[model samples]
Target: MQRIEFRKVIDLSHIISPDIPLWPGDPPVTFDEVASPEKDGYYLRRFAMGEHSATHMNAPNSFHPNAIGIDAYEPASLVRPAVVIDLRIQARDNPDYVIGIQDIEKWEQAHGRIDQGSVVLFYTGWQTLWDDPRRFINADDKGPHFPGIGAATTTFLLEQRRIAGVGIDTHGADPGQDTVYATNSQILANEGIVLECLTNLDQLPAKGTTLVIGVLRLKKGSGSPVSVMAFVP
Candidate 1:
């Protein structure tokens, strides 16, 4: 007897909610009902939260001076072919691991060159322990210990590959340990974007996928929370 096979697809994005861990100092997400059928004629609710609360987009103005506003960013830039480069091995060994040139080289050696205009998503496997504050932040006397793209690697992707942007499964594009926000500053200055607080990347194939980031059109806003999704073929 012969068996038939079917393609399996997985979503590689996080669900944003009030309980999702947010960066310290940001206001907590709030939801309140303004009217209800029991009290009035209909039901209506209101929400209040920072733009950068959960899975979100980062505009040039986020770190650069007088950069493009979040609203002005082209919608076309939000969707693109993507490549997932796994750094879980290094991250497991070093919680503060920074994705570097060597990592890119290794990936290219196996998967060929990362195409220009691709949205490179780095998988640190940090999302697995996101619920634990201690493990998520790994805060200490020095600072938080989380993984992110190194300055050199980010620069290389921007200058060499001319990538559209970068994404990560961690809280920020810059590591919790980065003091200068080097990668963020440079990337934004170059008109490159960053998608942060992503999850479920382990379900995606390394290549042959597309990432769609839906950002709210906030007038003159620096950055905003985004509804992210991945399409696999």
Candidate 2:
């Protein structure tokens, strides 16, 4: 038997606060101070936010009727081999960039085939602009602008590769400007899982890592905030 060892753990989730930019029209987050150690014996806080706020996971139910919710998947299915696809340069030049088939092909060529049940993360370096909501959303009269996976690439991963999940360090897996959400629908139709608003992906290697995703087991919830960690040996 091969012994598995975790040499390092890296956080891939963004800290959620009032400053965290949410999807337009989504409810704002609230953190209430219920008690303090100095006065109420122990510190306590009550908080609430949109289920999709911060680093979060989206189940197929987000789009497909009768599809599984965030709690339906077994814990084992959520832990899988992870591969990071770096496209920071392209995203730097064009914030509206969309990861295409060529990007996947090139990554596979340099590394190896993306094995089935693998978790693939797109590193567009968008986390760098997280400090400012305006820049992060990149919204204006023309709507928001940010790099994301295109419909074709998303379809290939879900249909062809049969990946366990996909993730990105943006508002969502699809471009903010894609009001129609065609790509998102395709993924959901294929029963795909998505982790959005990830951060610190640049710290991971191309492959040979395991992603430990922490998702709230909300009952019949479409999605929920998640905390993702990478175990690298």
Candidate 3:
């Protein structure tokens, strides 16, 4: 491969740490100092975290039985064309809003039909709550509430556009209340990547940004933490 040139780069990943909001039952992020300069000649630390926590990508195995893992994704496929659909106003009006086909069509009316193999992203203004776990999670007796792609919408994208997958600035690709993970499962079930907890969607335009998704090549791993970057044209 030739040396890659630089461009206006924007990071679309959340900073992972103990304080990052996590799934109700997922493993906690922890770091322990295994060696320090005071005790040893080197400074080193060990860390533990869940695959789905923080900013991450979900592979087919995450939802389907006996499916391929994160490592199976071809390197060339990881860097993909991406498009963002701004739904901040709708999400602000209703925290539990689910993006439907109509919303996607409305975006297309302005941005043109989404190209095949593109990764669609939804910017719901949720990134603003990153610092506040209380509001970011927004859980209640019912369940967590946040904006996400609807199952039917996911079906449309897969069938109509044959997109690579979808991403969101939330913990799950499905609406937070959808414990069944309808949207999340549907995408991965069809072997599409589902990027979650991404940030800086606000900085990306409706199109023209190429996504450079970085996922750990974990063998047979259901999912892996991701560092998603955008190269704006």
Reference-based lDDT, each prediction: 0.83, 0.86, 0.89
Model 3 score (lDDT): 0.89
For candidate 1, write residues 1-233 as lDDT tens digits.
Answer: 62323255455556655677777777988889999999998999898888777778888887877888789878777778889999999999998888899999999999999999999999999888767745776778887789999999998999899998898988888888898988888888877778887888988888878777778999878888887778777
In Å, residue 232's CA in model 3 sits off its true spot by 0.7
Better of 1 and 2 by lDDT: 2
Candidate ranking under lDDT, highest first, comes to 3, 2, 1
The CA lDDT at 47 in model 2 is: 94
Alpha-carbon deviation at 222 in model 2, angstroms: 1.5
TM-score of 3: 0.95
Give the 10-residue window scoring lowest on summed lDDT in candidate 3: 1-10
lDDT of 3 by residue, 1-233 (tens): 73334468999998888999887778899999999998998999999999888999998988888989999998888888899999999999999998999999999999899999999999999988988887988888888999888989999999999999999998878998887888878888777879988898988878988888899998998899999989887
Greater lDDT among 1 and 3 belongs to 3
lDDT string for model 2 (1-233, tens) is 63446899999998989889787778899999999999989999999999888889887888888988888878877778899999999999999998999999999999988999898899999988888877888888888899888888988888788887788999989887777776778866766668888999989999988987878999888898988889987
The best candidate by lDDT is: 3
Backbone clash total, candidate 3: 0
